[model samples]
Target: MSTSAKDIGRLFSPLQIGSIVDCVEPLSAGSEAGWALELLAERPELEVVPIERDGAVLGVVSRHVLEGIVESAWKRFWQKDLDAYVVPARRSVEATDYVDRIVAVDLADVEKDDPGWYIVNHRRAYLGIVNLRTMLEHLNHLRSLDLRRAGEMQKHLLSKKPDEDPRFRICFYNRMAHEIGGDFYRSTQIGEDRWLVACFDVAGKNISGALATSALGAIFACFKLFAYAGEAQLTTGLLNALVHEVNPGDVFVAAALFYLDMKAMTVEIHNCGFSPVLAFIPQENRKIACKMARPNLPPLGIEDRMVNDAPQLIPITPGLRLTAYSDGLTDMTDPFGERYGEERTIEYLRTLHKSSQADIPGLVGTEVDKWIGESHLADDITLVDLRFL
Candidate 1:
């Protein structure tokens, strides 16, 4: 099925893109061929891509590709990872080509997406099949219709507009994921002497989480307009009101809101139920990690009441940096299922602290992406970093 640029937006909606898996690894190709067949039987609509060998495309297996190869001998011989099966590619396309070509052609006509996937080569090689879902996602973000407008909306979300402020710098980098995530950030003056900087994440990914987050931003903006808070009650009340507006099953937002006292060089932190906030101190050459006491209340909307009524105030020192992020940072699994959890997070933060580079946000962001390697993100990631100048 070919779709025009005009229709691509509807095609890549959260519902459609979420339906496709980035890649799937089948059970041993040489052993348990019967089991593999049974697996495909359960998910008949899924398209399967075989691992490539040397320079040849092997395995024509899809959910239905193995129905005919049900014999015991076939299953036993081909069940081994690469030994049993050797399906060669009859044809292939370079990844760097154009999108219109693929869209104009029927799915049966072309072996890949409109342009296909491209690697970082002078002459990039043909890199596997372009499943239907990936093609639609690529077009939805960059297609002809309202491309400029989409850029502006993302800019507004990130608050990256050039004229917003010259005193502070904010940088946002999203390395082309399937959906827009829950990372929301903002900087505004709450009092003549105080400025607020926030970095937070909502649960889930794509539009479902994005809608809740966008609404959360609206709520904060409304609160800022009507009832600005120097008091914990006001802040928690606003959080309860926002939570009450959303449905019960929705994931909650974990955030750290800082009211900076520039004159005193101090800040007050409200640890609503989220990950424990870490304060990185250079003098101690170590971190002071703070955890809110348990009996900790539910995050934001759970009961429309502050779960933990006491406010924790920590002293902020000059030359010390504050790192706040959602669980996505610590919860990511290596392809082997090892988590890049709190221990690694502190280690990485320490390494960056010693470095002479000044762009803290970008430096930490880049390292996190490299750590994940080929493993895709399962949730939205938002990191808010503040360093006193």
Candidate 2:
């Protein structure tokens, strides 16, 4: 739940303003008016053309203005000076100006108060004028295409729910944002009463995060395969080691791994910079807090040395319900600019505990939806709920 402004910024990156350069043509002021007509004839797509000199954009001439002036008295008023038509490069749009840089604002989120121009780079000595109307139209087209791809990605990545078990009631939900994201979970039954429940959030978004999560999934298969292959090693150290071997970079994942043994009535958990595993067991007069005892475990695949604490042990009693969720839930923000954080999550669990319900995960999601006021999830959401019968 320790999210940052950078986190939300990554999900909706904008298109570069320099991408519109193809619509402009640079020319020198010495060029004859006939050359402008030739340029227009050769490329009729451009609305306005800039005339440059010594690597600096000095002025521009638009076809609309050029057509109007040429057919009017200006042709006679400046019959001797044809170069008088060139005008200074525009520095204001709707009377507002902005510095040049890679624009990181999402096109859909732009406001009427925003500046009409953005310079994407300084590689060129001088910046040119921009047709704000045409640029925004292009952005709208790209946004439609991107949303379509995101929809397909969501359908392809959401796996079918595993079969129901008589020993435990399981409810799982995964919701992708408008763009593909890096949140996933897995549930594996190793034996009659042995299961592994894992959920992780890769510190990435969109295509990069999706690829990283897919690689991590392959590593997870190796772990599950080895466990059934009789060389079983269910340690966070092993997970950390495998990631270190495959991924030696700045990126890492927040994960919580749980091993449930019904026969022994115990749950062993490894919390690697992941949110504490939350569980509530109804006792005669009080609610037991089975949240991970150590909450400061470091995330996996970061430190060269082992940072995750050893797996902690917890005794399980009858009527125990637990929930595992990604940081997306806690990062949910409201219209009032408040995050639906851990404190509210704990309070929800307390309420669910009192009700003794089986749909803890589903209700938690509903609570978040009500708080955020929409189904358009800004971040990926994943949740898992289990109740020991």
The 0-to-1 C-alpha lDDT of every candidate, in the order given, reads 0.53, 0.61
RMSD of each: 16.0, 10.7
- Which portions of model 2 miss their true places by more than 4 Å? 1-61, 74-151, 175-178, 191-193, 206-208, 221-235, 285-292, 304-310, 354-362, 373-380
Task: Assess candidate 2 and give its lDDT.
Answer: 0.61
* lDDT per residue as tens, model 2, 210-296: 766767667656656766421113455666666666664777888877777778888777677776678776667765665533344
- Residue 102 of model 2, lDDT score: 21
Candidate 2 similarity to native, TM-score: 0.62
TM-score of each: 0.54, 0.62
The 10-residue segment of model 2 with minimum total lDDT is 93-102
Point to the candidate with the largest TM-score: 2
Clashes of each: 13, 0
Which pairs clash in the backbone of model 2? Answer: none
Predicted model with the maximum lDDT? 2
